[model samples]
Every structure is written in structure tokens, then in C-alpha cells.
Target chain A: MPRLINRHPGRGPALMLGLVPFIVLIFAYLLGSHVRLAANPDDKLLPTPSTLMSTLHTYAAEEDVRSGQVLFWVDTMASLERILIALVLSASIGLAFGLAIGALPVVRAALAPFVAVVSMIPPLAILPILFIVLGLGEVAKIALMTLGIAPVIVRDLALRAAELPSEQLIKAQTLGASSWQLVTRVILPQMWPRLIDSLRLSMGCAWLFLIAAEAIASTEGLGYRIFLVRRYLAMDVILPYVAWITLLAFLMDWALKILRSRAFPWTDMSR
Target chain B: MARVTVKGLWKRYGDTVVLENINLDFADHEFVTIVGASGCGKTTFLRILLGMEQPSKGRLLIDGEPVSPEPGPDRGIVFQRYSLFPHLTVLGNLILGLELRRSRVLGKLFGARRREAIVRAESILEAVGLAGARDRYPAQLSGGMQQRLSIAQSVIGEPRILLLDEPFGALDPGITADMHKLILDLWAANAMTIFMVTHDLKEGFELGTRLLVFDKLRHDPQAPEAYGAKVTYDIPLRRLKNDRERQRLAIVEASGSEPSYAPAG
Candidate 1:
């Protein structure tokens, strides 16, 4: 008898309800594939589910005749290595620059405007310039990812440090904290959780930059593999590759989120 | 112990004057309570005493010497809120002062030194009745518990002077009485001069050995920034118990007829 808006489901029903859309989409895909396959057996636009699964298995398990390495994992490792290096580099640089810009007036006056200007420049537009200068090597790909996200992380952390309650700074000073001590003892520790949060938010952008760079120049990577097979209209290979990339991105984000909550429990007070 | 002396003190921010031509002397261990209307300079004056702000004119002397320009361990402060670090546990907050003082670069102690600091921190936590909550974060604690921790954080440093700016203003009325008792006990136990600013006049009368009232004795209707608040009433409460009622009545009358008291000059 309750109004639809007021009828809130319990946990089990809510979870089941959340899956309804995914279920509908999958059923629709299967129906479309069957219809397309019944008309023509050589249809490549919508591969049958069985064909898609076999293609995924081949790519994942079979060894390539030329490279002798499992192509899927080799591509995955190549992509992961580039993205992780860029992420680590971005995090460290962001923390240092952010704290410096936020805590000290001199540093802020000098660098805040510069950082703002840098962040405003669309990172993708500079990919050609990066490629020319750093060359079509691993450095260019890593640089692209770092450049795309580091400014954002720096700007976010700088604002966080700047908005720290003035009272806390004064209290720390009264406790005999020097200028350096203020940064390390008070400001630096609080930046860890926020840094992790910034990294989580930056993951998608990092992946985009990685893919774009790899598609343009790399010989071996997830993005390279997808583009390499696209000329033949290989939907089966491309579809599985896209799904694998999504799964990998989801897993990395999930791992970082779990690490943040576990290591910095105080940051999430709602729990 | 520290004896503080103020002479011809003035504070101004550009055209607006906050406090003007104030002077006073506080002996060691005196509990001075300051009361005034909003926008008055009680807080500014306290900041000057804490070395967080500089006087526009004249001097502030502690023990017959000019006070340090920068805040040091000699002075401790507790604001109304945001005084405790959110990232630190209750016990971590207590030993932070000692750690900063002893280990200049790292801001941390190690081995035997670390154990000693923890023991000291535990004793202070026990004193503040936060022993059970030593591992808890500030957000998890109630308002009263947080304020208690703030006070404990300030007192553990063994400062010569303690400045509190409306520390209990955000606490519930039921919890204030307990806070008052805790502060009074701390004041008695530590040989430190105390200055507290409060909006509640009766609280000023109850807790202080001396009461100071800051009110502007001059005003300009056209240019309101022409004048600033001064210490108009300095009542010695402890020595003159018989005169309490009379002084209270005088403050009420003065505040009631504030316009008459503020001359055009």
C-alpha cells in the first residue's frame, strides 16, 4: 500500500535490483547475436557468445608463434609497468609540490599561478610534442600519463593543505614546532589519505593516456593489441580485450580503495 | 612561574582599531577572566599575549623582559574548536609537544625515549579521564571528551602560561560544570598564569581570581573604526569577595547604558 517512492527495499532485494539492468543488457545482447547469426553465419559485427568465449580463451591461453610469449599477459605486464611507474612518480611530485605551495606563502605566490596555468593546458594536445621530445619509447608513454594527472593531484592536495584550520597551525607552533616541524608533524601525515584519494580519482585519466600513447606508437600493450586486430574487423578479439582492460582497471581501483580504508581508517569517520 | 606586564598596548588592522592604549600586570598563577560584547578585542588581546600577534605600539613583558615574538613552549593555547589533530590518537596527541621538543628533526622519539614518552602520555591521559579512549580518534569522542583532550594536550607541555579562548562555548550546559571542575583542578595543580575569554559573565565571576571587561569608551557614528575597546573594568575578585555583588551590579548598569558611556570623544 506504500507509495513507490517510499518503498525502500532491504539489502538482499536492493542488491538483486541493482543487477536487473545488467541482466537486461546481457539478455538483449544474446538475442541480437542469435538473430544476426541466424540470417548469416559469417556475421562479424555481433559474434555469438560461444565464439566470443573461445576467442577470449585463445588469446589468454595460447602462445604466439612469433613471440613465443603468452600475448595477453605480455601486453598486460607492459601496460601495468608503464602506468605504475607514472603513478608513483606523479604521487611523489604532487605531495612535495602541493605541501610547498600550500604551507609557504612565498612558494605559493611563485608556483600556484604556474601550476594553475599548467593544469589548464589540455594534456592530450601535448602528446605529439612529448612524442617528438621524449621519442616514441616507453618514456613518452609514462610521461604522458604522469603529465595528465600530476597537476590535478597537486592542485587538489594544495587546496587541502591551504584550507587546514588556522587554529591547528597556531596550536602546533605553541607546542614548539618549527616551520619544518609544522609541515612534517602536522600537514604531511594528513596528506597521505588525501593523496591516495587523488590517485584513485586519477586512475581513469592515467588509463586513457596510456591507451592513447600505446595505440599511437607502442609495439606491445593492451591498446596496441586492440588496434592491431581492428583492421580485420575482429570484433571477437576487440570485445574481449576491452572487457579485460575494464576488469583490470576495476581491480586496480578496488585495491587502492581497500588500501586507503585499511591504512588510513581515521580518514573515513563514517564507518 | 611567569609574571606578565603590559604597557600602552595597541592593536590595529589598517584603519580599524581593535584594542587601544591598554596596560595591565598579571602576577604568577593568577586566573584572569576576560568578558566583553561580540566584536570587542578580548580575543585579539589574548592572541597578543600568546605571541600569535604583535602589538601595534608599546610592549609586552614577561618576567621584566620582552615576550618572544614567536609562540614557544612557554605559552600553550586551546581554541573553541579544531584544536585537536584529527589524524592523531588521543595518546599520540598528548606526547606530540615533548616529541617535537626533544627530537627536533624527526619529530619522533625512539627506543627507550619512545617508551618514556608513552608512559608520560599515559599518565596525562589518565589524569584527563581519557585513559580508556587513548586509542580512539577525536571524531569518535563526544564534544566534552574532545575538549578535555584539548585541555590535556595544552597542559601536558608544562607551559608557563595557558590561554583559553571560549573553550567550553560549544559544549552542552550539563557538560560545562564538569569541564569547569577539570580546568580549576588543572590550574591548581600547574603553577601557570591563565587567561580565559568567555561570553558568559557569570562564568567569568565564578572561575577567575580577576575579571577584566573590555568596552569601547568612545565611538564615532560616521567612522566607526575611529575607536577601539579598552580594559574599562579590572576587578580583583579574590581579594574583594564582599564587593562582588556591587561590581556585578555596576557591570550590568554599564552594559545596559552603553550608549551613554561611549562619548563622542
Candidate 2:
């Protein structure tokens, strides 16, 4: 008699039940678009300023839709490549220094106030300077994402390292564990279950920040496509791209969840 | 094998004395339980024995040599609350000491550390009746099983001396008794020295080889300037081999309750 989650008793129906809200959201959002169109036919359904202003249905059938789709696929690949590069760089930076700072209490205390001060300024505030310094190239995007994500990653890890049980750590020391071994055995293994959750959350934030950064400066990413679509008021073109990006972000989260479950299968999902 | 001897042990946190002139000895393979009411300095005494702290006026000797105020391979501690790592599997939790503490770089690279660690952990877990539950996480285990897992970890490290602070105090009576039996079985098998702090009277009687009830009010001359705790009694478990011992064990059991204190002279 599970009460909170399983309203349905069995698998087949339960799986179907999971899909109901998503199905309903699509139906509802699309229905609202129709109603909005019916109420104001003269009002633009979507933005398509690049080619020409047109109705939602009219632009839905144009080359803009096809062109947008092509742009989407290419830019998605580029964005993905950028994110992977950023992940490696940030993970390296985050882990190397994170472990160092996280492990040492003196280092953490000395740097904590400064770290907190810098975090509040918002990484997005210095985009123009980053653009000037690194140029509006893939390097800047990758660098920005690393800078943006690493601190958060390190901060999370540092706090976790701090939260590590004092007794076990004392026990490890009593057993003659080296510092490296402490990190490898006690820290990382324990860090993983949390690190996975942070990684998943960081993935979403990375996407959001990357898309924003790309939109402001990128000529060829999904953000550029969204910006390009906005010119001609093509709602249908813009809408699907939004839907795809949303769906992809969701999929990445779900996929990462699967990876987490596979990697550390022992942890029960924390609701 | 070290004969851990503490002499005129003095410890204090600021102005409050925790253990004063606490003289005690744990021979190789001796299982001594330090039982007292809470804040009775039993744990502080254990920590001092483990070398996590130094006695202000006393000396701690391992094999009759002074030990550093730091943890070493000779000591293994099992805390009641923080028994196992929440993220690691039972096997992973068990081998952490060996993998991280014993193995060298070559050991890690040759993959010997991992292999040997796993082997040791598996055998340890099996000894504690946790073979079927190797893949289970600490969070997935019941309190009793987790306690067993913790015991395996401490015991598997094969330290010269084991320090446990209220290891079964958190469990229900049924689980606690089961854990006590498991601990007894492990002790019987290994015959290594064990020093545990406990407040459970029945548990102290059930698990201890030698019972030392800390006298929180006993005056110590050397430690008067530092910490000021005293001992009530140190009873040999051999005396409690039968039901008659249980009757004599009344004083050992009663020490856990509030007793009127004489002002230190």
C-alpha cells in the first residue's frame, strides 16, 4: 500500500500514468496557442524577423522551418562539443584544486570569504570582457563555462569534504592512510553519490549559461538559431526548437540519472 | 603486540578535567570495556589510548614505549553513529583501511591493493555474516547489520588494539544482543585486544573480558593541576564466568546509575 507515488497498482498502467502529464502539457500548450491565434489573427504567432513577417501556419511550411532544423542539428553538435570540453576542463580544475582546498581546513578557511565574494558577482556579468579577451570563439565559450561551473563544483565538493564524518577520517588516519589514499578511497568513493547529483544539476546550469553566452556572441549555435528565428515572427519554427532544447535538457538529466544508477547502484534514490 | 599502558592519565578541555590520573593496562588480546555514565570521560580515555590526544600529566606506552599523540596502524576505532560510509558498498567500506593505508604505489598499480583489499574485505564481511549483502550500501542496511559491518571493518584491519565507542548503544535490545553475539564471536576468532566504551550494564557484562568502571570523582594528585577524573573499579570478567558473578556484577551494573559523590580532598 504505497501511498505517495504509486496511485496505480501495476506496471503497464503505471508507465502509462507517467506519460499523462507530458501528453497533457503538449496538448494544453498547443491548444492555448490555437486559442491565442483565434482571438487575434492579426497578432504574430511567432517571431521571424530575418526573412519576412508571416502567420504561424504560413511560416510552419517555409524553408525557414527546414533551415532552422538544419541549424538546430549542427548547433546542437557544436554546443555538445563545447559542453564536453568544458566538463573536462572544469572537472580537472574543480577536482585538482577542489580536493586540495576541500581537504585542507586552513586552505578552505583562508579562501572561503574570498570565494563567497566572487561567487555573488554572477559569472554572466563579465561576458563582454571575456569576449574581448578570448574573442567570440569556441575558446571563450569553453572558458566561460569552465569558470562558471568549476567554482560551484568545487564549492559543493569542499562542503561535502567538510561534512565527511570526523570519526571515520580519524579512523583512517589511525590506520596509517596516506593523504592520496584518503582522497582516492574515502573521499572520492563517498564523493561520487553526491558528485553525480551535482554533475546532473551542473549539466542543466551549463546548458542554460552556454545558451545565453552563445546567443549574445555565438554565430552558429542553437542560441543563434533562436535569435535568427525571432526575426521573422515564425512561432512554429521557434516553438519546435524550444521544444527540442527543452526535451534534450530533460533527456540529458534522465540519461545522467541512468548513468548515476549504473555507476553507484547501491544508493537508493533520495526523494 | 603491544602492552598498552597508561599512567597518571590527565586530560582536560579548557578548565574541565576529563580523565585524571587514569592508570590502566591492556595486555595483548585483552578485551576491556570502559563503562560509565555519559560524560564520564570513558570516550576521552579511549581517544587518549588511541593517541588522538595526549594526557596532560600522564604517559601512554605501546609495548612499554611512549606513543605519539596521533593515530597509527596499531589502533582502530569504531564509532557508534558513523559506522560506515553511506555511499560505499559494504565491501568498499570494509577495505578502505587496507587499500588506503597498507598498499603502496606499486601495490595500487599492480592492482594488488584493489584485489587484496577486496579479498580482505570480502572475507571480513563473510566473517560478519554479510557475504550476501556485499553489494548493499550502508544506507540500505538495517541498523544491526550496519553495526556488524562496522565491526567487520575494525576487526578486518587487524590492528593490534581495537577502540570502540558505544558501538551497540544505538541499537534496539534485539539487534543489540545480536550484535553483541557477533562481536563476541569475532573476538573469539581473532583474540586481538579490544577496548570498548559502554553504558549498557547487561551489554557490559555480556561482552567484556575485563570491566573497568570509571570513577568520575576519584581524586588524582598528578592530574589535579590538569584533568581530575578517577576510577570506581576494575573487575576481571573471569569473576563473572557464572551466575554467581552476575550477583557480584551488581556493583558493576549500579555504577551506571547516579551515585553520591565525595568531594575531592
Interface RMSD per candidate (angstroms):
7.1, 7.5
Candidate 1 structure lDDT: 0.90
Q: TM-score per candidate, in order?
A: 0.93, 0.81
Per-residue lDDT over B116-163 for candidate 1, one digit per residue giving the tens place of the 0 to 100 score: 999998988887778888998887878788888999999989999999
- lDDT, candidate 2, B60-96, per-residue tens: 8888888877887778788887757776778777776
User: DockQ, per-model, please?
Assistant: 0.39, 0.31
Most accurate candidate by lDDT: 1
Second chain only: TM-score per model? 0.89, 0.82
- Looking only at chain B, model 1 earns a TM-score of 0.89
> What's the distance in Å from true for residue A171, model 2?
2.9
Model 2, total clashes: 16
Which numbered prediction scores highest in DockQ against the true structure?
Answer: 1
Quality of candidate 2's docking, in CAPRI categories?
acceptable
